[model samples]
Target: MRNNYHGFTLIECLISLFFISLFFLMLSGVFSQSQQIFQRVESREELEWQIFLIQFDKITEKGTFRDMSSTALIFEREELHEGKVVTLAIKYSSNKKYVYLSNNGGTEPILTQVQAITFDRQGDAILFTVRFLNGVEKVGKWTIP
Candidate 1:
């Protein structure tokens, strides 16, 4: 009796297959979770960047620099309402953690979760800074005659 069997036993093959399947299953789960995390991060970053841009764009238009402080800005915008000039007030409230724009006796918030806002002037350039709740900051500049 010379049985020269050179193949894996049925039980051994089943065990190997089970382990391989488990490993691949775990790998796919980890990859899927990581993908979700990455997507969320990307979306948050885009939203943060847009918050900065929208606030700055709103203020860069033609307006009289009535006054400004470390956390607020007051200006008379060159906008017309009912065939009359209008002035708008813009400011960042640390207490509420939001930026507000008010015009014609109406007030509304523009952005939220802002930690700070500052304005400065150098030569012909008006500079502004915005700080977000996550400790991120953005600086913007506009030239004025």
Candidate 2:
């Protein structure tokens, strides 16, 4: 007598299950790593923002207003070397998606991924509004001293 069964044996079944679980384990690890990378990127962007704010505060602290518009803030500060006043302009370029700092005739971009900026005078202060590319908005007041 001969008997035939078309089915997986216990060892075969166990091996297949183990391989499937291993695949899932690797997949979960990849997912977790991706999440960690995203979190790190987010924190780095926040750090960049903090640095930008510190630089902006330092530049505008004792600056005298020269001119201001919706897209630019021009100011003058005395040079420490020769007692000569130098013109500085903070300009937001919608086309370039950056905030530029221009000293005298030289220009350099200071902040990036900016959408729009507005400067308005309020009493003895300047009310500034910044709109970021990700739809975040910041409003602040800078008083001239």
Candidate 3:
């Protein structure tokens, strides 16, 4: 007696390979999308940190603002900084208040809760406040006299 054995034909093997390739191609798309999302998150965090540092440095420096008054004043001007106009205003309400930094035509408030500062017509003795997106507030005072 003779026995006949049969294995997968060439066509069957080729079909299996094609299916596997298709599956992997689909999976690769998903993996690439996830990687892009992670990169975007990292970029956002870096940008936030850099902006916080710039704001901190500007506030700590004494020459950033010249004087404090009931009206707003332009403290520093940078054409290359995010295309936003930067200014410092001294707002005297019922009590003495200071606005250290502002932006976007002085419509955006960067710093608040300013307690006291010395301001003269000569633009001497600057005091201001710094606030970060994390809600951290820092008070900086400088005396020119």
lDDT of 2 by residue, 6-124 (tens): 89999999999999999999999999999999788667657766777787787787577778887888889998988999998889888999888888799888778888888889878
Which one wins on TM-score? 2
Error of 3 at 24 (Å): 1.7
Better of 1 and 2 by TM-score: 2
Q: List, residue by residue over 1-145, the lDDT tens digit for candidate 1.
A: 9999999999999999999999999999999999999788657856865875677566656567676666666777655556566777777777998778877798788767678888787877768787778677767776664
Off by over 4 Å in 2: 1-3, 94-96, 115-139
Give stretches of model 1 more than 4 Å off. Answer: 1-42, 78-83
Give each model a TM-score.
Answer: 0.60, 0.72, 0.36
Against the true structure, candidate 3 reaches a TM-score of: 0.36
Give candidate 3's total backbone clashes.
0
User: In candidate 3, what are the lDDT values of residues 21-73, reduced to their tens digit?
Assistant: 99999999999999999788656645644564476465545335444453443
Error of 2 at 31 (Å): 2.5
Worst 10 residues of 2 by lDDT: 41-50
**TM-score attained by model 1:** 0.60
Question: Worst 10-residue stretch by lDDT in candidate 1?
Answer: 76-85
